[model samples]
Target: MDENKSYLYDFIKGLWKENPVLVQLLGMCPTLAVTNAVENAIAMSVAVVFVLTASAIIISLIRKLIPAQVRIASYIVVIATFVTMADRYLAAFYPAQSKALGPFIPLIVVNCIILGRMEAFASKNGVFRSILDALGMSFGFAIALLLMSSFREILGNGTWLNMRVLGSWWDNWMVMILPPGAFLTLGTIVGVSRFIQTKLKKA
Candidate 1:
C-alpha cells in the first residue's frame, strides 16, 4: 500500500503541482517556440514524452554502471541517441510536423527537463519509480503545451487545429501568434496557475 501510494504521488505531482513548464520552468525553449500552433505543440509533446520516458528507463537501468564523474556525459549520449531516432522517424513519416518542428527536435538532447530528470530522479531511483516520474513529467509537459497551443491558436488564428471555431465576426488577435504573445500567454497562465494553487491550499 505504501509503495502504491508513493508511485501515485510521484505520478500525480507532475500533472499540475510540479509541472515542468508551469511549475518547474524547465524546457522553456520548445514551450514558447513551437507552441504557435496546436499541431506543433502536440508533436513536440509526443517527442518529449518518448525521449524523456525512454531515456529515464535507460538511465535508471544503467545507473549503477555509470561512473559518477562522467554520468552527465553518458546521459547526454543516451538522450541524443533517442532524439536522433525520434527526429528521423518524424522526418520520414510526419514530414510536415517534422518540418515545422525543425531543429527543435534535435534540441531535445539539451532540453533541461529530460536531463534534469535523469540527474535528479532517475539516477538514484529504481527503474519503476523513474518510469513513473518520467510519465508524470511528460504528461505535465503535454498538458502545458496543449493548453498554450489551444489558447494561442484560438486567439491568434481564430481556429483550433486549423478548424475555425470562432465565427467570422471574431477578429484574430494578431499578437497572440507572435513571440511576444507566447511570453504574454505563458505569463498569464503561470500567474493564474499560481493563484489557483494558492486558493486551493487555503481552501
Candidate 2:
C-alpha cells in the first residue's frame, strides 16, 4: 500500500511541483514556436509524451549496462531512436501536423526535459518508477502546452482546435498568435503560478 502511494505521489508531483515547461522551464522551443494553435500544441505534446515515455523505459531497463563515462551519449542515442519513430509516425499519418510542427519534432533529441529526467530519475530508478515519472512529466508538459495554446488560439484566432469558439462579432487579438505573444503569455502564466505558490507556502 505504501509503495503504491509513493508511485502515485511520483506521478502527481510532475503535474505542478516539477512541471517541465511551467516550472522546470525545459523544452521551451516548441512551447513558444508551435503553440500558436491548439492543434499544433497537441501534436507536439503527443510526440513528446511518446518519446519521453519510451526513452525513459528503455533507459531504465538498460541503465546498469551503460558505462558511466558514456551515459549521456547513450541516453541521447536512445532518445533519438524513439524521436525518429515519433517523427516518422507523425509524418506518415498526420502529415499536416507533421508539416506544421516542422523540424521541432526532430529536435526533441536535444530537449533538456527528456535528458534531464533520464539522468535525474530514469537512469537511477526502477522501470515502474521511471514509467510513472515519465508519465507525470509528460502530462505536466502537455497540460502547460494546452493551456498556452488554448489561451492564444482563443484570443488570437477566436477558435479552439481550429474550430470557431467565439462569435463572429469578436475581433481576434493578432498579437496573441505571434512569437512575442508566446513570451508574454508564458511569462504571465509563470508569474501567476509563482505568486500562487508563494501564497500557498506562506499560508
Candidate 3:
C-alpha cells in the first residue's frame, strides 16, 4: 500500500480491529471509572484523543533524538503536558464534568494506552503516521467506553444519556452504577467480543 493509504488504514484500525480498549485492554482505570454516563465517556474519550494525538506528533518528531534509556520518561512528560491542558480546559468550561471525572484527568498521565502508542508506534513512525495511529486508537477507546457506559447508564439508572429510556415499571439495577457494575459490564462486553472474534476466525 502507498504511504497515504497505510496511514489511513492505521487510523481506522484503531477504531475497531485493534481498539485500545477492546483489543489491547489498555487504560482500564479511566475506562471503568469515568464511564458511568455517556457524557462522561465522551469527555474522557475526547481528552484521550487530544493528549494522544499531541504526544504522538511531538514524539514522532523527536523520536530520533530521544535516547532509548529515557524515551519512556520523555513520552510521559509529553503526554502529561497535553493531559494538563485537557484537564484545565475541562475545569474551566465544564466544571461539573471536570468534577465528575476528577482525578482521572491527571491520571491520564499514567494511562498505558498513551505511553504504549508513543513507545510502540509513534516513536517508530513519521509525524503523519503517528497522528493517524493515535487518532485510530483514541476512536477505539471512545467506542468501547461509550458502549460500556451506555449499558450501565441504561440499566442502572433506567436512562440513556440522562434521558429516560425505560418506564417507571423498570427497577434500576443500582449495581451497574457502582464499581462492581463497571467490572461486570466490562467483563461481559469483553467476553462477548472474544466470542464474536472466535466465531469469525472459525468462519
Instruction: Evaluate all candidate structures by whole-model CA lDDT and list the values in order.
Output: 0.95, 0.94, 0.92
lDDT of 3 by residue, 90-130 (tens): 99999999999999999999999999999899999999989
Q: Candidate 2 residues 1-203, lDDT tens each?
A: 57545988879888998899888999998889998999999999999999999999999999999999999999999999999999999999999999999999999999999999999999999999999999999999999999999999999999999799999999999999999999998998889988998899899
Clashes of each: 0, 0, 0
**Model 1, range 64-168, lDDT digits (tens) per residue?**
999999999999999999999999999999999999998999999999999999999999899999999999999999999999999999999999999999999
In angstroms, how far off is 14's CA in candidate 2? Answer: 0.6
Which candidate do you rate higher for TM-score, 1 or 2? 1
What does each candidate score in C-alpha RMSD?
Answer: 1.6, 1.9, 1.8
Full-model lDDT, candidate 1: 0.95
Off by over 4 Å in 1: 1-5
